[model samples]
Target: MSRSKWTNIIFLIVILLLIIPQTRLPIQVALHKLITKVNSIRVLEEDNSVRITDTNWQLKSEKGLLKNLNQSEGKVIVINFWATWCAPCIAEMPSLQSLYDAYNNKVDFLFITTDDFKKVSYFKNKNEYSFPVYQPYSQPPNVLMTKSIPRTVVINAEGEIVIDESGAVDWFSEKVQSELNKLLK
Candidate 1:
């Protein structure tokens, strides 16, 4: 093949490679921005009077035994479904503990782990958290029909599932505090 032809082909391939990502750059940026906006806006029900039914799911407390969360009535219950392997779950744990310490008596904070009782026991011993910890039954919670990790559900005093967020969230954010405050009130 002629050198010019070869040069032209190479140039065309280079141009295509460069142009493709550039062409998609705008879409990628827009999608990223959209995701940021969506995550920033917390979706919560405006009507705060809805009450959640008693799920009666058994959860293990920090003491390494099964306990029922439904017994803690007339208080805000924050049930965090986390696993020891989840980085986000570990990162937000301190914040959850802080929140629990601030309102442990007034509100019930349950850190429900799907991990086996042995692993949970080791983790609890390694890191001492003041909040109550529990292991959900081998099955997932009724409210959270799915077995996805890092799910945080905020049940109000009336047992209504107020905030059912799946994935890592800024639990310490003003939005979360506001929601918790509203529930407390």
Candidate 2:
């Protein structure tokens, strides 16, 4: 096909996708998930291979209580930024849950929400998601704060951002397990 013809075909598809919102969203979401999975595997590396200075980010307390974001200081830490109302976030929770179940003993998983406390609690209960949930008590480190979510950040024992991306990802994939296993070692 000629380059001009291909460009016009692509433009028409995009226009149609925009005109009919429902048709394109699912395809876009599927593409995002696939890209996330593929890129995650391509970039997987051992924890010891990377390091960064301590961010020293603390979670805000609720009812005079605080969370131990630092508890897994010497272990793999997976923090997911999500909200109850976010469809993509909800769609990816099951995979996150599976990932947590497999590595709960070796890695720390935190599902940090920026939604109302009651809503989060109810959503968690309703969904039967068991990962520890919290909202930022104060402003998080700049690296953690972003305009878009469900951004997931993986920090190794040495505190490096192993994988930082914004999209719904399949956390329980075998390749992901292979990568996390290296971090645990």
Candidate 3:
């Protein structure tokens, strides 16, 4: 074969390598970690009644129901918006699960998704994720109705939006965990 044909073959391989999921996921994750910076700051402890997290949620399974954020007042709350079809969401889920595992007892982790129950269930079971997933029984606070997927809003015990990120985040990062710990204190 000519050198041009060999070059064309190599180009096609490179394109296919980038197009395939298994080959592309790691590259995307690396790029995200390189560009996404987590800021460290103490969350305000001031009292506020904004309550954008004032929505009711039903557990994805038959486990139970979350009354409302009002009932969860005085507790550190994590409300994450994700979808089963989102690649970045899927990529970040393991870290979310790790965060859940570490703080599940101390934090109210609500993995809220607007996707259908069937799709959510399939995704959960396929991935074997232990984190609690829910569908909103009522609309979330206006601050959360975002156009982006994998949005995360961390409400300190004082009901402040301490960390409101629009894209996938490394929830188990040291800085994020420190902020969460500060909220508990």
Please report the candidate that would top TM-score against the real structure.
3
**Per-candidate clash tally:** 4, 1, 0
lDDT of 1 by residue, 8-66 (tens): 99988766765796544444434433443345325457584346564667776656677
- How large an RMSD does model 3 have? 4.4
Models 1 onward score TM values of 0.67, 0.72, 0.75
* Candidate 2: tens digits of C-alpha lDDT, residues 1-185: 99999999999988888679676655655665665555443443564334545456666432436765665577788889988766567667888999988889888887788688778778778979777777787667666777887888888887787877677777788877887888788
TM-score of 1: 0.67
Instruction: Pick the winner on TM-score between candidates 1 and 3.
Output: 3
Q: Rate the local accuracy (lDDT) of all candidates.
A: 0.68, 0.74, 0.74
Candidate 1 Cα deviation (angstroms), residue 36: 11
Q: How close is candidate 2 to the true structure, as a TM-score?
A: 0.72
